[model samples]
Target chain A: MIRRLLLFSLLGACSLPAQFGLFLVQNGQDVASSDQTYGFGTKPVGAVVNLEFHLRNSGADAILTDLHLSSTDFQFIPSAPSLPQAVAAGTALDLMVQFRPGKAGAATADLIANGVKLGTFNGIGLASVTVSMGDGSPVPSPLEFGSVKRGESSARTIRISNGENSAVLVNVGTRDKTFQVKPGTSPIPIAAGETATIEIDFVPAADGPQQSALLIDQLVFPLVGTGLEPPFPPPTIDLDRADLASAQQGKLTVRLASPSQATGTGEVDMDIQPSDASANLDSGIQFLSTGTRTATFNVNQGDTVAHFGSDISATFQTGTTAGNIVFTVKLGYFTTTKTLRIAPAVVGLDSSKAQRTSAGLDLLLSAFDNTRSATSMTFTFFDQSGTKLPPGAITVDASAALGQFFTSSDLGGAFSLHAFFPVNGNPGQVDSVEVQIVNSAGTAQTARLPFTTP
Target chain B: MNRAAVFLLCVAPAVAASNFSSPLVGLTGDAQGKLHLVHGVAGSFVVRGAIAGQALDWAFAASGGLLKTADELRVLDAQGNVIGRRTASESQVLLNPRYAFFPETGELWPASAHRDRALLIQSAAVGGRVIALGPADQREIVLAACRGDHLWLLTFDITSGALKHESAPGGTIGEQACQAAHRAALLVLEDRVLLANAHEIVIQTSTGQERRLPIPRNHGTRIHRAGEDTVEIEMSGAPSFVLRFNSEGERLYELPAAEARP
Candidate 1:
């Protein structure tokens, strides 16, 4: 050992208290990756990554002592070589070191190199290599640890409706010991446009506010392997705009609020409960009449509304979405809330009647509002035999002015020519007139008259 | 208003809207048995048995000869009776008293009494014509007759008021490729003419829209009638010309090849 130490390192000039320690790159390019580097991945448990390293000239000065590299995770592929001699020469001609990775996590090992027996450098040459181990996933959507309202269990299906790419496997986990998970697995592969279900069962410790992690791991997309999931997206929820008001003008006009449905056509579960059920003075709303209700109004294409007005003020019940609805109210003037529904129907055409025109028949029409005020009404003529007549002009009533004539300009394919009437409903009342339908041959027929109040 | 008032005021006296739309399709004819007509649309109505106490009725879906214009057909003083006929022709067919001959599908003189500018329309294409009677010493003469595919109009002499018949140019003579039954005289339905070009069919419609119907290769001219108002056309094989289509093309019908209207 003395002669060998002399020949080992010829330089013994400058030195520290006891030379220094070592950290070896080991004898490896890691080409096959069998030579373990300080990285985390698949690992053979307990099997050391056989590797070694030795020191040449560690520094400018000659080192004083035997050098060796060792660790619990590493050793020579063959075995530990004999202790090396040093200090004769200023430096070593050849040097080598070796090592292997430990468990798949941050591993630590001290590389003992160029240390004397009674030297502090024994532990001083400590170097630790850390590699993190994990099951990778990114941007995975997940649900809470099967925690949902008792009645809303079906809503617990994890929604992956908006996934752009398919995933190989999705990992659902819970870190909480108390919150158990089912279908213990990760990375359930799914094709594009497919959804995967991860069933889990949980029982709260106390039924109160139970909290636990719903971990998502090992998400494999089209070509990507598992990676850490992106930070969870901010929470979201459904929002509704609530606005309530009393029916306008002692009247209740119900109409389809949507293009597809008219008023009174939709389902409405409503009740007029008295704030004070014991208050015997108040009777719940009873219905008097449904009024004139017509149906088959094309929701967007047709108009459907129901109108009602009363002396008492009351609240109406309806669905959350806007559009067609039924109206229910109290029967009499003085009463509690009552419900009435005009089976969804489209009422009077919103358009006003136009001015005068003739169709070879002597007929006239008049319309009015509730106040007995005169309003314009459309008049049509038919030959004596009730056959539709062609176009002719009729004098306009002096009472109504040309308020941008309903302009019966084109009767379309209807034989009767059209003219706009400009009557003000505030003056008098009139509805419509029908020319005689009987032929003018030998017999004479009476003309038909049509009228309305409001 | 109270309940009764509201009820009375809001409700209108309901009047059942009458579904009266169609009109009487019949028209009265004239005092004399001079003229007759069907729909301005050139269709023929048979002199079916009487109904509603009348001898004739204007039937729907009638079949008949082609009229160049709607104004040319009329109902005279008698209701539903055909009256004096008129046709808008590019050339005038002068009627007079003379003897002429038709060579297209040879026939002889015809006889009838018509007071107006009655045309002794010697059958050049489809139907025959009416003639005028002459003087006391002799009986009315019947000289030239109808020759199908072309006409020889014999205009009577104006001065003496006699049969002064003469031959004049009528118009082109051919059938549409699809339904050649209805003859064409240039004036009938020119706008409905669909030209079969080297590769396609093109039609100039009445609404001033031009439409080109796609035709498969190796198709020939075969106009098919599918309904009272619809027509379908197909070509044979590898159309030698461009296909053209037109819906405005006047509709024409005719007897079979054996009965080429004379």
Candidate 2:
């Protein structure tokens, strides 16, 4: 009977032994590993997948012990992870259970935290689970950028989807000044269950510059996803600057006057402020009635600190004409106000002075005072039409018969004098006369040869 | 002991005197002009010229009192003199180092580093056959020289690797041979091709042509024309200066020693 009793005690001791178990941990939320139910892809060479697990104190008291298990494909968390406070009852700690994807193909691995046979606790303490890692479908893809023109506006959009349980942020930017993309109000937040579309507009200010980089960022729970986490698209992009000119009425020309670097076909955002307005009133630029005139736009080089102005000219029509526009654009952190003054329209033709035979000829233009402040002036030329030449600014009058010159239309050119209406291509000779100028101040000064043709 | 003798042998007084004062005669316009003057210890100097806006090439080298051709510019000694002067062709003075140009080949028999050496392409000669005389490692010649009476041009062919020579009638070139290292010259024109020696300019054309030239005895050059024969040769001013006939000969103009411009 003693022997039987000892045997029974031994059986009891065997049954009452401490038990242990190990399990899997957290994986990304809603990882739809299309083919694999466990949400794992083909484990490429040298891939590690961290599986998360939760541990609970099911024992009546805080059971402190080391966990031990055997598996080549699995790994345990910090050894003897902080033991939960002496559990008065059935309290628990959601400790992490990690399982890294091993090699490709079907593989199995066991994980151990402390020294313990994790399988031994299957029916007693907890349960043990096996994990497999492999390469799978449903991986995040990249975004592509399209072409844009110089001096013109264009836009593009990248589509990114969140296949995980958590939301993610998408950011966009480039380093080159040749292109500018409209910044969004805030980082685009894409929900795990939804897709976010990013809109990027670019205006290339220079030529041949490219725009690249569209990034997706967010936290990814370990063990929940397949394949690589958050891959980046090719940042290098091809920015085509084929369209430099606007199709509309006016021509806008922007140039980099300093640094002497050659800019290619593209529009770049330079100074923050807009272009100068008064550039249209340039005076020194006078176009020939029969040919194209010279108009220029000026810019000051940042290096020399000297100011340069560009001049442009167009033949006078009923209205204003346009030429290559120079951008006196005030850009960047500093805004400099450029002054553009309308130079007095050129009075001289190809030549300033002309020699004619003494055979009293008809002069074309009536000379007037240059100092005249009023919008309109009535000046008179002597019947003899002879005046001594003087220096200084003078004006031209329309009605006064300074000389007889004619063309079909009003062609803006230096005033000339002639006896007959222009029959052929010639526009007669130049006309000159002495004139008096009257201003609002009642000040009068006379300049000689107010309107003389070159 | 041999090195000392070699040093003295190399140190011998430079014999080739650069005629810098003479102007290139018979050349017209900037394209066919004389090569600029250069003073070097020793090395190959490129002679670039233009005639009617066309370019030409001429290269030369000088060594220990003996001029030679080179593939790459020969290394210079401590005094900046050509270390080794290349000796090529039987008629080195007139062949390798072109004395004059041949109408058939347009090749300068003898070429000059600046004036006398074996340069494939000459800046003052025509453009055609380009040959080079530098290193044996080179497969072809490197320079081409074409000289016309009114045209002087030279070209450098990074390709073909050769130098040729060409010329026209009534044109003046540097017909002198350089015998010393570090010696360089200029091809200038006045009444005709004249060589500047020390302070005096020696006429390369026949003495008869020199007698008729306006270049008077004891007269100095004020200005020079680079191979321009279109307009009459006029040398004006000075008591010793007289209207003399500028003789014509196939003479090469050498740069004079460094001095103030006349």
What are the RMSD figures for all models against the true structure? 24.8, 27.1
- Model 2 residue A315 distance off true place after TM-score fit, in angstroms: 32
* Decoy 1 TM-score against native: 0.23
Least accurate 10 contiguous residues by lDDT in model 1 chain B: B38-47
- Candidate 1 at A440: error in angstroms? 24
- What DockQ does each listed candidate score? 0.01, 0.01
Worst 10 residues of 2 chain A by lDDT: A121-130
Q: State which docking tier applies to candidate 1.
A: incorrect
lDDT tens per residue, model 2, A211-241 = 4443333221111111111111111111122
* Chain B only: TM-score of model 2: 0.23
TM-score list, all predictions: 0.23, 0.22
Give per-residue CA lDDT, model 1, range B1-262, as digits (tens): 1322322332132221221111111221111211122111111111111212221111111111111122232222213334334432322121111211122322222212322433333344223432111111122333222334443333433333355444422222222221232211111122233334333444544343545555544323433211122222323332111111222243322101111111
Estimate, for each residue in A303-352, the C-alpha lDDT of model 1 and write its tens digit.
Answer: 22222232112122221111223333221121122233212111111112
lDDT per residue as tens, model 2, B1-262: 3222322232112111120111111211121222223211001011112211211223222111122232222223312234443433333221211222332433443222432433333332334322222211122322222222122323223334243332222322233212121012223232233333223344444221331133333322322222112111112221111111222233212221111111
